[model samples]
Target: MFNLRTRDQIRRVETGKSTSNTTNGNGSTSQFGFSSMDGERQPLLGHQATTTLHAEPGFWRHLLFSAKSSPGTNSPNPFVRWPAQVWNVTKITLFSSWINLLLVFVPLGIVAGELKWGAPWVFTLNFFAIIPLAAVLSFATEEIAGRLGETLGGLVNATFGNAVELIVSIVALRAGEIEVVQSSMIGSILSNLLLVLGMCFFLGGIYNMRGQDGHGHEQSFSTATAQTTCSLMTLASASMILPAALYGVLSQAEEDNKQASILVLSRGTSIILLFLYCLYLYFALRTHQKLFEPEVSQVSDSDTGEEEHEPLLGPWAAALVLVVTTLVISVCADHMVDSIDALVATGKISKTFIGLILIPIVGNAAEHVTACVVAIKDKMDLAMGVAIGSSIQIALLVTPALVMLGWAIGQPMTLHFETFETVAFALSVLVVTYTVQDGKSNYLEGAMLLGLYIIIALAFWVSPTGALGKV
Candidate 1:
């Protein structure tokens, strides 16, 4: 009799027709529908209607059970739901790319470090480990940024996209590897400006040409935005040149306190650059935001059917993943830094080559791939932002931050790069300036950038470590 009564009540609630009324202990009459034990009204079980629930869930419940479960499944144990949601998010994040197969290296890296493995083993394992970790970091950062809307999202992306470089640099700086810190900083800038941007132009040109009914096609981005970014790069180049010039002039004069003078100058300049970065952010995000807004281009008929994927994780889950990934990256970076001396002592590679070429490649690999993929889709503005904007952050933000960090830590990290590196950086910026000056890109321009990068890499590979000392 009780079971039959419950069935009739559920049917009435499902139909959204509560015919019965109940008298509460306080003499208040209430409609007999779905209600919690606390007398709060619940939504009809089968009524296909939109309703807003004002209940606030607990923090742990919100975090763990944010993702909806699959349809038609019976309610499992409460303990199983959180883990299942986590597993779903993890699977989506890690298995999205074949590169994540390298994640096996993360644990291998830790094991190698703990087992007292040789420097080669540890370095190799940790180096590869950072690659997938970088990819995951990029993914999680985008997921979180997506929820923040465009203006704040761009800021979040700029800060966290370079988190790996920042982490590795901090580790090296703390270890007194000033050269490693400086080289990695410039390397990241070069890789983004030349290698990543070059690939974007090249692939974008090729893809557009194939998609369109033309032989000599060109991909174009916003000229004003490109000019603004290039001007900043020019300023960064000037910053590099001025310090090296000061060092040179002082050394030529036989000044007794040259290093001390340069140290003070570098610290002051870093603070100024950081200020300039803040201004740039304000200009881009607040005052003149429309200038940086992405320009829409006509999509080709072949591309119109493609769908964008929604973020796999909620903001909280993404933030959690980001924190976890960063911690893992720090562990891997520490292991890698510990092995650098041994790796260099083998005579097979120099510290300069490792810092300038190899380390930046690891740090910027995911970003490089992302820029090229977007460029191929003809989203030149976004591609340019990823490529050139990243370089700007490294130059105007990360480099300055490292100098400040070094000051606090008693290391002499400075803007004074080697003469050759400064020259390469200047020339690379010049080439990019010219390439983007007209707001048009073609395969030839891209080929030129890649050619120049290859030349620079070869020169570094042959140059001995410490041979090109700071000016």
Candidate 2:
């Protein structure tokens, strides 16, 4: 939850001034301790008020679980309810209404596509409808992640949060839409690495600037995130570069042999990537756990006299939400795919445009919003984890799973991407790896990333007819 501390409290947190209890009107006093760099506590006489910064009508209670007061309430606010802070703002404003409004198109797409109303309308509606459902999936993943600790939470967020992209690829693969599957996966990697991470840093920097001005405090960057992201990105870059290089060389001779070689290489690479992903999970969840932990604060609950735990949306409920949302996304994705054939027949949009730009964007709408919102709320760890983690999942988990699944279905998806896309993929990973190396972020970095994405998008959008090449 968002918190607003009195100037005195802010000063104490900054200066490590001691705090003492002051008698209330009821003759009760509370003790507060402030720690200095030398690990000594000092006591001063008085009370400093803390305020919860925001709240919604009814849902705030459940989300906050342990919060004592809502925004503007006269009662003392104990803990900053992070879930409430993040959820309420997103729900009351853009995410909530945007999701609801877009949902109306769900039936529109179904009806239009099923009834053959027209390819353009059906395709547009299906695309729009997935945006909200993706948001819902993202929310469920975050809620579930909240129950798990950061390491596992991040893994969960990355894996299931990206189920939309996974399902889309699988469905497209089955339908023999190889171009859509490959481009969408590639686009997913680039967008999450560039666009999502960029926005998080940009928004987080502004919030950090404000916090520094008022309280002289900023959320620390996670070194573990930096190391893990760099390693995984390096892996992604190598995976992409190898295939691109191999195809460029080996694919120049016999057409049939080229296809077989590409398929063989893709299958082998998929197994290796999947193994690496499992190893990453093991390292994160089993060994070296402390590296990813959120910094601990020594705030004790005044009433309960215990540490405050993360308020969670119970595991069962979270799982149910995830399951339901994923089902909806799958249904909507099927509808979306149904329109693809017709839309391609009209000669209006290319598969590259839909895969590289439109599909990835809609597929990631929720995660994009959640990551930026969390960053703004000063949860940079979660935000960075979601952004980089999603890209890793796409590269290591989803892409490989799709390739194997394609092989099973006799569609035989390959990592043999267009030359430009392969270059773009490698460059995107390198740029992000470089940016996160210092474990810090700022608005300028975000702007640079967003600029790159725009340039990449335009490159795909403006390609001449048949220039993207057949998959």
Candidate 3:
């Protein structure tokens, strides 16, 4: 079903550019566009030379559909992305996003039901062990998505990830415990950085090395300047946490409330950092549009169009289920935290250690898998960007969100990071940044990243005060 020529054409359309086919040779002039006269613009000139900037492979799908269907008043993402709105016309997207909502809440409902018996074990079971189950399911969604396409795969991944984050954040708010929530968050970060990134690097390197070509494509570093800059900023923000924490500690004698103030300063740091990172993303995406060179497959012509139809579900029926599901899922996220925390306590392991290493990795497992797959497809830029870009989000955006949320609940937690955590984050960013700066990576670099990640893990294990102690 996947024709080589058609797939090649689809790639071209996806990248959104064309070679200079402005003038054809005399023999191929008709192929370019039929001419009406010997010395005149071709009859099809309007069609052939139309240069569009945002032409993804699905450009025609949306265009053709929009041409036939009237745009409803409720529509937001119109024109080129009208296909995405296709779900609005049917039940698929609404159903998927809403189903994701319920998945987050179901576990919490079970816990509330158990509260009727006033059973402590039930409460503990729900708190410590059950949350990881949801995380595993959430991870499964990503795993399945890898085999699927964007319409289904990507939609599922983004919606579910956001849904879980939205729901759990609220629960953690009410539990009134910074120790538990922050620890889990740290876990998510580790899952993404060391485990997720390391797997991708290993797979991509091995795949490329095994190919007939001597080395997979050697990346040119100039192409990834924007991403590199963001990574460095992540390092900078992370590094500042060390001094900030130490400042609070050292200043505690002069100001007994310095601990409280550290949280304030840390949150402030996150706000400033997110603003800068957003700017970086905007410019990087823009530059990618202008300067990125497409692979050969992206240059060919192909017919990826197909017959379309209305979907299986009705409008309001879809809406109700989605809304209910989302609420349920949100409830479950809080329940998840309880279970995960209980597990940590029962085992007598360091809560902060688990979080710093596990939570982020689990949270971003899907994105990590996608990056590895993208690299195999030879989209090196997108692959590298995914790991580094997402890291920036966790370090800057996610960290800050936790602090602000703490404030909203009348618990003022500072944005100041622990000394060891700050140093580990800084070292990780710097080593990875320098290696990737040249825009070329080999198995060796991937191995080095993994090795550093191991050392980071070992340090976390040995340090009793999280990152505060020398490993």
Candidate 4:
């Protein structure tokens, strides 16, 4: 009789009929139906069983299906939906701040170039255009870094965060705008060391000052890390200073061979700096990582709950955005480079001023915004990494790479900065070294750095084009 009842239940399940509930000996209803036979739960069957048996579609199939489906109210046509979906994904990937709104300038800048608009228009539009693209680039880099873990992530951030400067410098280098390339390099370094770092300290200090108590608070970071970074900056300054000094001495005594000698020295120095940068990466990321670690604060259980470590975009999507944004920036940079001469002639602005002040400000704008935001969040260690790390990259990596590139392309790109610019670089490093020596920051130090930057900018504004020998 039990075997016959089991066969009947199987037949019912096969026929997709609901299993009837049975009452147990204890007078309780067994909703599982078969529970009455052994007083134990049994596997669900019939219509419900199909859900468990159903297989999920593969990635390609799902993607194809999504593409075929309507993209909701955005569009009804599949082709239109696909594009809308891509745009939506791009926005999500690149849109981190209000700064992204300036992305509109990208198309405008490209159009201006095609329409043969005046240099000022092309330069102005592309200049603004690169700002938002840079911010997007920064966002994409961070997304990728976040997914890469801490050490590899730091390297990724270090490399790609300065993509704007690298791309623009390369464009200028290729165009034989050697002064623009060199000045922009030093400008990036100075801006990061001074403007960005100062803003971080200033905004961070103010944010921390609003403590729960009446007294103001001071923010602190790893002193070991700060000192190490400052030491590297000093090394970079020495690199710049030696080349300028060599050029100066040789110009007086060996004018015929001076240019060739400076070029050789720059190439050799660039090779060394690049090698040092590599070793520094190994040291920071592998062996001496502890020194660069942020100070961990004690938190209660509630506060210490797990935070989301997920990246905003998938790995491939982030990389795609990075490549696309970089390409766009390259285009805009090329347009800007082509217009630099005309801009200089009409605006009567010194190339030194543009390279040292305007171009750097644009290239480093994303870093500036990022550092300040993190600093305000009291992440001084991260803020410092973004600010000082960028400068170090420009000095030790981008500048040298440009020299090698010039060597390859037969351009006379050297490390010989003008004497005044060299002095500014040296002084800027000196002041920053002093500021971060103690690993503690306050608003006052930030103000002083900003003041120094202003003084340097003013001096350059009145100065004529020097090393490039352009009027």
Candidate 5:
């Protein structure tokens, strides 16, 4: 029998997005339906959830269908339905996978660096090389997770989704690029919260605003998720606040005890943060898992209908691909880090800009795009999960893990960020919390977030290189 849960699963499968569904009970069989961005339902024929959309129609076909079948007294105006049409085009083009072709730049980067190519050239090649490798890593992870069922799949995706950024940070840490690592950490959180999420809300607002009456349907953001995200961001701000204060007080003290005290405090804080993160995962996946499930809104009395399930790559094959792609990312990151000094030495850009802007963008490009795409499709829950979830991981998992890893390798990384970075981090958390409090969003709110991010970015861009000390 088709229920709300089953109907949502069928919708995902029909659109070629893979998700695991388990039948809970039995009921009367009914026709399948596709849900539009405005929560409107269109009926289609099917029973099994594994049924695939064979030879799916192109953008024009869907647009025409949407225009003709739309229930209204007004004419079939494309402008009124621009968001839906744009999404249709996005769905078609997503399959092109042209980024895979950029993989060739990996070996080319290695060759250029070995042949004494200039810093700018090597950095450019290696930076571009990381983008495709990051995509490959993401694809391989998704393929493996698709086979693991929803609960475990969500866990895996949350844990490993930011592998590219983590890898880059680790490589930079090894090379004594503490400022670079620190800036990138804050940058990842900012980019996800502001840039990526803003785009999602902005596009979602546009789509929802184009509904029949033009006021648009209210986007159903998960209140549970939003509250939890705000709490986590608060925790992140607290974690950094103490360290930043401690760094300031100790900076004027004896150098001998200053570094030692900071290291001890950092290691202790890292341990605590890691413990907190584990608790969060347990609460999210085990204790309150139901709160995290996708909420379905029924626009009609739908009947039982099944759709074809999309298959995934074999586990072993997916694992192998993940391993190989991650290894390639590591190599490229090493070269990229090696070239950072050269690039900044030329006076064209600051280290802050490189870390806060360039590095995070390169590593997270694929995930960023995925977040926006899901938002465009009106999957606000999943979109928030991607954006907010990644930020939490960076704060609780990646930052602490890097600190511990650095200590283990004798590099002794501390959580002590500069004054400006500390302020920016705190401000970001406060602003995002305010925006998400109502569990609603619009393009204007999104623009506000983006505007704040731009201001912070410009501040960093103009700061002289090395002005911020390495703690």
Candidate 6:
């Protein structure tokens, strides 16, 4: 049904860690990790609940979340005191992304008018520039959360991390630039693997290097079943990219007549593979009840305490912004399409190369920043989730949609990606999935992932056509 709950559950299953346990009418637990507790566990009494005399048990949750959400505070900003703290963090990040988009859009609009033409370069520069802006925001967010002793980091990333790149994906779809769309897939994978993961490992390594608390060993992540599920799903997604690249670069012997066969093959394979993986994921969760249930039956009495809070923008407003941003990003691509095409040609890059590398890079910019931010806070699993999740989205969803839309547009692009690209993506998933399998990652592993990207980049740069496997 395309509900976010299913998506969230799939993701939780993938990561092997969602604590949203619900009890059924029969007195058994649901697939999620919660157990049935009696009426005594519920905190009651109307007057005390209504008043704020005592701080909740969430003091740690709030402290860690708030301290890390914003910087320059010795403790949680008493002024912005769990729920309000999370709201404060969201407002700041959303506001930054909003301003960041304007910084890119407004200047580019002016330059585009002056050039008497389109200029994706303005957006390009804007996209890249935000990496630094992102770095600052990320660092500040984590540090603030730490100081305030709150843990808003994950929520922050969800709102701005891949969400930003998701915006860019809509942008590429609108541009109708097959090259840009393909490249966006490439960009997204690279940015997640290299730029974001790399920064997290590098910075986290330095932070943990001091080692006074020996807390680097702490990982409250989740079950092996969950991580494996996510890891396998990611591999499935990355693998799906193969036929597209292979067909693109393998041969053009019957280039004109090749279109229909490619479409049928690509579409057929995508649906089959996507469904298979989804089913596999469902069974992995449903069948393995042991994996979801914690061994120690007695959960702490205070664990169910709810923190006092409200949404930053009311539910309707946040939902509206999310929808509106997608629409705007989509429309903006319309102006950039022609300009970006010319840039690729004058710069002597192939359409496949442009699509495979550049577009993904721009599209994934926001996500890259957000992943690194989470990694720095030592939430490597979530960081890897964003990276692999983005890749899966590009492969399973974006690529097929591109093929369909291209057909409707009369251009008729295929899902076939190049061989080198296909192999590289597979390896990227391997590296991340394996490295993160045990719920641990270090700078050396981060370096290994980044090195893979660099090797691929150098190869692409020196290649005759600026992509892989071209004759």
Candidate 4 per-residue lDDT, tens place, 1-471, comes to 001111122212222333244232233433322223232322111000111111343423322332111122123455654464464455464445578888889999999988879988998999999998887887677667765666677678668767888899889888888888878888888898888888888888887876678787888888998888889999999998897777766646566588888889999999999999988888887798677665665112134342232343545667878898998898899898888898888756878888888899888776677668767767677678778877888888889999999999999998888777788899999999999998889998998998998898988887765533410
Each prediction's number of clashing residue pairs: 0, 2, 37, 0, 11, 40
Number of the top-ranking candidate, with TM-score as the measure? 1
**Compared with the true structure, what per-residue lDDT tens digits does model 3 show for residues 219-284?**
322344445544555655554655465664565355546564565566677677667655544443
Q: Kindly state the number of residue pairs that clash in model 6.
A: 40
Tens digits of per-residue lDDT for model 5, 1-471: 001232234235234533333221122222222221122321111012212222343423433432112111111454434343333223322332457678778999988777868999999999888887887777666656665766677666666778999999999999999889999999999998889888888887777766568655656687887888789889888888887777677767897688788889889999999999888877876788777665654112132133433433335546766787788788888888999999899999998999999998987887677767667766677677778878998999999999999999988688888778888889998998988888888888888988999999999988989786644
Tens-digit lDDT track for model 2 on 127-211?
8888877766665565566556656665675577678888788778888988889889999988888899899888777777645
Error of 2 at 203 (Å): 1.9
Taking all chains together, the TM-score of candidate 5 against the true structure is 0.78
Instruction: List the pairs of residues colliding in candidate 4.
Output: none
Candidate 2 TM-score over all chains jointly: 0.73
- Candidate 2 colliding pairs: 1-81, 1-82
- For each candidate, what TM-score against the reference? 0.82, 0.73, 0.60, 0.80, 0.78, 0.61
lDDT for each candidate structure: 0.75, 0.66, 0.47, 0.72, 0.71, 0.47
The window of 10 residues in a row where model 2 has the poorest summed lDDT is: 1-10
Worst 10 residues of 4 by lDDT: 44-53
All candidates in order of lDDT, best leading: 1, 4, 5, 2, 6, 3
Least accurate 10 contiguous residues by lDDT in model 1? 43-52
Model 6 alpha-carbon drift over 4 Å, by segment: 1-107, 110-176, 210-258, 274-309, 348-358, 407-411, 464-471
RMSD of each: 12.7, 11.0, 12.7, 15.2, 12.0, 11.7
Total colliding residue pairs, candidate 5? 11
Which candidate do you rate higher for lDDT, 2 or 3? 2
Error of model 1, residue 106, in angstroms: 0.9
